[model samples]
Target: MTTLPTQLQHDLQALAGEGGYRDATERDVTEMRGRYRGGSTLVLRPKTTEIAAAIVSRCAEAQLPIIPIGGATGLVAGHIASENQTGVLLSTERLVNIREINSTDRQLVAEAGVILANVQAAATAKDLLFPLSLAAEGSCTIGGNLSTNAGGVQVLRYGNTRDLVLGVEAIMPNGEILNGLSPLRKNNTGYDIKNLLIGAEGTLGLITAASLKLYPSIKDSCTALCPVASPAAALALLSQLQHELGEFISAFELISGQGLHFLREHFPQLPQAISPPPEWSVVLELGSSAENELKKLAESALTKAIQKDLILDAVISQSETQRQQIWSLREHIPLANKKVGAIVSFDISLPLSKLALFIKTAVPKVQDFDGNLRINCFGHVGDGNLHFNVFPPIDKLACNYRSQQTEIRSAVYDLVQKMGGSFSAEHGVGRDKVSELLQYGDPTKLEVMASIKKALDPNGIFNPGAVIDPRK
Candidate 1:
């Protein structure tokens, strides 16, 4: 169904120059995470948007599928090439560039290949802030963030990548450039085209660059690790803090005692604040422009909560080193779990009030598979998002517990559905969750998405088997 002509290959090689393209070796076919593997005929890395466009246009003429890859950090197998199709892998690694940082407009225009951390650093250099902070910021690209509409620790205050984007420039399936990179605060345009491509996951188009919104850097900040009784108590404390601190409450992350236990057992180098961990812990952060009175405000707020029994105990970070240590504990849970063994990670969201009930019902069902099965629960409680991961059991009896993955997933998802929650919250449904999407996604919404995909990419050459399959 796909063809790669000799002339087009020569032209691509000429345009990209030496060492820009490679024949897909057996190792390259295997994915970075070892979850999804595919055989790609060619891996093409274009240094500029022009070269990428030319390669894409030639492929369009030849009817060859093009898979756009950026950092390959996505949890879902969204970037895996199909075995049935002859595809050209478009790696955006060569397109790494921060074109401009306009301080006047508080906008940072960066190529899709630029890593999220690099973009944040560029913004920080100008005394500005790009508040899209994720665990994978070190390796994930801006284009991947834009494509996935990534939600991270700062989503409570700054919002997701979708909210932070000012505009986007992408290459359509027909190899036409859709340049909509305007840093306007308000625009009554005919249609918001940037929104379409922001979360399309390279299914509709290849995101080339983005104009991102930046914020004024915070001069004063306060960080606290507080122990709570339960999820309800955590939510109650968050409500009280929001009432007191208002917009200064930048991030409020939740972690279970089990999650903390994992860190203590696995990451022994990280210091534990509480000797006997409470049922739940809340990592609260406040950012402000005024530096003089931040500590007093934070201490006073914690004192009030402590008196009311909302928080059992608290530890405030006194220095930047201490703050980083506390954060490292929160950020390294996923990696710690990975080192231990395989896990079934879920990014689910539920109603703030029903979070405790959902967890109460789901945790036991997951543990029923194996008693020693580690349930590492942690996420942004302010937005009701939880990264509920189930680690493989350590005992011989639980060796084949992976066979019950389907039952475990069903139990968790059923509880979420009963609570009127989304199965896939921040993470988009890639090929891994297509069946779940079809089961839980609204029929009318799915129909509209199918129609849009059909309209944009009739040939279905762009990232097939991603969010929606055309054949279905």
Candidate 2:
């Protein structure tokens, strides 16, 4: 597959028809975050599952690598084709369709190319909720979300993408179709192959559609910005809220002072949720069907926490507009981080008891590797995931610190491992974290993964270099 053979190109053109095939552009091969670029000669956009199957079947016969991309909003280089190899890009953009929405059954069937925001709107129209949410929801597609097993603000309550999806219909690397898109709650027929493909990052298969689980609509809700003295206090406050609010607690996110500073520095026009942000703050939200009950429960929890000095300052949203403004602050932290580029960004997870200590120890230890580095630590603390990013000093550019990337990454990852945490939490092991996975991954787990990959994709034509590399 080093070069696209003439016969293979002709076969692809014939299979995809005239308009479906085109020369790859810069946009086709580049990833989000501008960190990875790939080399692809041809791009294919098939309109139907049958057409996609034809394209994959032809490529499988030619033994050419195929890279699957959706929305191109992934942070990891999962969708980026290998630069050293010649491949074809397969996009699911034309597959956008919402086949079904059953409010009574609490399920929605969506095609791979349906944008996440549109899914949310559809659920809203049915008086239901699709709880998988993130800043990239506007552009990220359902296929991409399930592929990456994406996590977002509400993971504390609804879980990740894997939990939201009940079934999926995907095409195996060898052009075999797996039709497991059943909306059954309990099906113990055999091994859970649907779960395998959900988080495989397209290494296992190219997902075409899914049957997703939806939840009851939020009739009443409350959003608050709580300033705490430390991560320890933040966790304690979360515990208090959950004890009182129970399942009503929807989201609890941790924000560090450094992240707030980045927001103030870059997005000055945005209204601040909590002025003069504390050393550490949390954005807490609660939702319920009973109007006024959610806000009342939240207020009671905060009143007790404030009395105990667990929370210092707080701002509760009084209206839907204000609530959106508060969430805007939480969502824009990543944008601010992008504006002030990072030397290395980590999506790590830790045990609840270990989060506070890990943050305290890792910040200074990472900075010791390079005194001028700026660390921004924040994430969905309720679910034990953290986005720990390293940046250059205010006056310096990220490019200037490129040489220290390895050192910075090693410092953070080592600490995370030592604290009984994972190097990757939500973002999958794309090209960027392949080495990290090899280093930190369990040997037995790796062996099983390789076995599965070999059995399903023996020719190594599916997302060639992602998750697990092709055999040499």
Best by lDDT: 2
Give the Cα lDDT of each candidate. Answer: 0.84, 0.88
Q: After superposition, which runs of candidate 2 have C-alpha atoms over 4 Å from their true positions?
A: 1-3
* lDDT tens digits, residue span 1-472, model 1: 2556778778767866767898766544555446678767778888888778777787777767888888788877777776777778888888899998999999999999999999999999998899999888999999999998899999999998999999998888888988888789899878888999988888888899999999999899988999998888899999999998888998999988877777777888888877776669999988975674777888999999999999998899999988887788788877776666555778999999888787788888888877787787889989999989887755532335657877888888888888999998787877778878888888999999998888988888888888895466
Task: Give stretches of model 1 more than 4 Å off.
Answer: 1-8, 23-33, 396-399
lDDT score of model 1?
0.84
Per-candidate TM-scores read 0.95, 0.97
User: Candidate 2, overall lDDT?
Assistant: 0.88
- Mind giving the per-residue lDDT tens digits that candidate 2 earns over 330-404? 899999999998888999999999999998899898878678788888999999999999998889888998887
TM-score between candidate 2 and the true structure: 0.97
